[model samples]
Target: MLWKYLLGFYMLLVTAAAFLYAPPALGLGELSRIIFFHVPVAWVGCLAYLVSMLNSIAFLRKQKLEYDRRAAFNAEIGLVFTILATVTGAIFSRYTWGEYWSWEPRQTSIFVLLLIYGAYFVLRSAIEDEEKRARLASVYSILAFISVPFLVFIIPRIYSHLHPNPIINPGKQMEMDARMFRVFLASLAGFTGIYAWFHNLHSRYLKLKAKFEEAEKHA
Candidate 1:
């Protein structure tokens, strides 16, 4: 219930900020303004996947059904954010790179990640045994998680492309001004808060679902 309230508040704040603060931060002239939403979504997507991977590991170690549910919920949320990130990134590319998409390594890796996790859900659906399903899903999640770093960092470094280099990298020129930074940070914080709220909701839903299934079997 607290999470629900927090989510509602965060969403309202984000919507207000998007209208009131975001435009000025985009230089009000550059299309790079999309980064306000794009960067935050991408960051949250990666963060969600990391949490999913960690939960997968925990499930494997503890054999707890709750961990499995957390992993699944995180992965689902991660997928949604990733899709938003990809689409927003494409829009940015069309404006900046003069194309809708390039065969950039980072982009390719993101696509692969999306496909892998999509397959994970398929695998879960095909399995009939609950224990077996959890075990297999956990394994696949770990493997996918291992690949994320390579996709996000390693592969992107090996090639030259129009995609911006990592912001935290030293010696990389930052194109953003101070005002843009403020709005960007705000968007990120707001989105992250929303993600946390959703994660709690999804985990609770999973727990309740498990309980319902258990009770049904007994009845």
Candidate 2:
């Protein structure tokens, strides 16, 4: 309960900090405020996919349905966040670049990435047998995740981006203002907590569904 309160408080703090304390960057003006929300969700989405991949690996090795549920649910979460990230990034683009979207490397790669996971859901729905579905979905999640690092990290570098510079850059040793950075870090923590909460609930729900189906079959 305290953790829930902390999560809500964290979000409120980030919203306030995004609007009030995180001053507009030199070039982008107030539109840069979207960073507090957009980046965190996108980061969480990417993280979820990575977890899905690991779960898939476990499922394949152990043939356990629980791992499949994990992989499936996290992929669903990842897709939702990816959609949010795309929409928010589009809004940020419209304000800064005068277009909703373009063939910019970052946007292109992300769009392609979305398609890859979009196919995952479609694939899951198309399959009928529960155990079979889990196996194939696990395979798909693994392959999809293998491509993710390239989509998120490498493609942006290969093609030039209309996206703005990152708040912190390791190679360039760059960073955002101290105040802005602190709020950004808080936003990340809050969203990560939100992800954990949803993940647990979703996983439990799936397990319950399986149990109910088993009871019904016996009856």
Candidate 3:
């Protein structure tokens, strides 16, 4: 698909830019390089959660099984990305701060998000009725997404922590230099393509699954 080609090219370009073009930060040195990877993964994870929330809202409004499937799959992908962000963040923190798992505000917020959505899958598995599962999962997804903003934006500001300045400042400022900015955006675009590729593949799988189940029931 087009996404596959885009993702491939993006990967190659970002790899080159990350290793070659992106300059080290004034203080962070080579460690600043992690931001190119970390920020995009974190951003896409949030994007997936937002998509899940939108689909959840659609399910509630339309009472459609398809919408619920979209919600579930997207949330699942979001949870995976959140985990990647957390792990990578911790690793980066380790190199920069001398340890992992300091229970920093940012780390704690993402950890909470992970638990919230991890329970989403659990709740679905615990329920046996298809319609009931969809209904409750939709509700839970909305509730889980409600905390995303608080965890991501509010917590970081509330606590005095070691995390560096944000890319976008509260007053709509850009924090990065020209060289860093270019690679950061490229990595973000590439990661987004990766998200679309996975989402489309998973969505198709869900459709095939429903069809197969329907055919089996008739047989």
Clashes of each: 0, 0, 0
Candidate 3 per-residue lDDT, tens place, 1-219, comes to: 776886898799898899899898888898888888888888888899889889989999999989988888888888888989998999998998899987778788778878888898899999999899999999998887776776778776776698886787887767788899989988998888889889989988988999999999999
Model 1 pairs whose backbones collide: none
Local distance difference test, per candidate? 0.79, 0.84, 0.87
CA shift at 29, candidate 1, in angstroms? 3.4
Judged by lDDT against the true structure, how good is candidate 2?
A: 0.84
Q: Given candidate 1, what's the lDDT at residue 67?
A: 86
- lDDT winner, 2 or 3: 3
lDDT of 2 by residue, 110-178 (tens): 687689788988999999998999999888877776776666777776777777767778788655777
User: Global lDDT for candidate 3?
Assistant: 0.87
Provide the TM-score for each candidate, comma-separated.
0.84, 0.90, 0.90
lDDT digits (tens) for residues 37-123 of candidate 1: 888888888898889889989999999878888888888999999999889888877777778888677677667767877988999
For TM-score, candidate 1 versus 2, the one ahead is 2
Clashes of 3: 0
TM-score of model number 3: 0.90
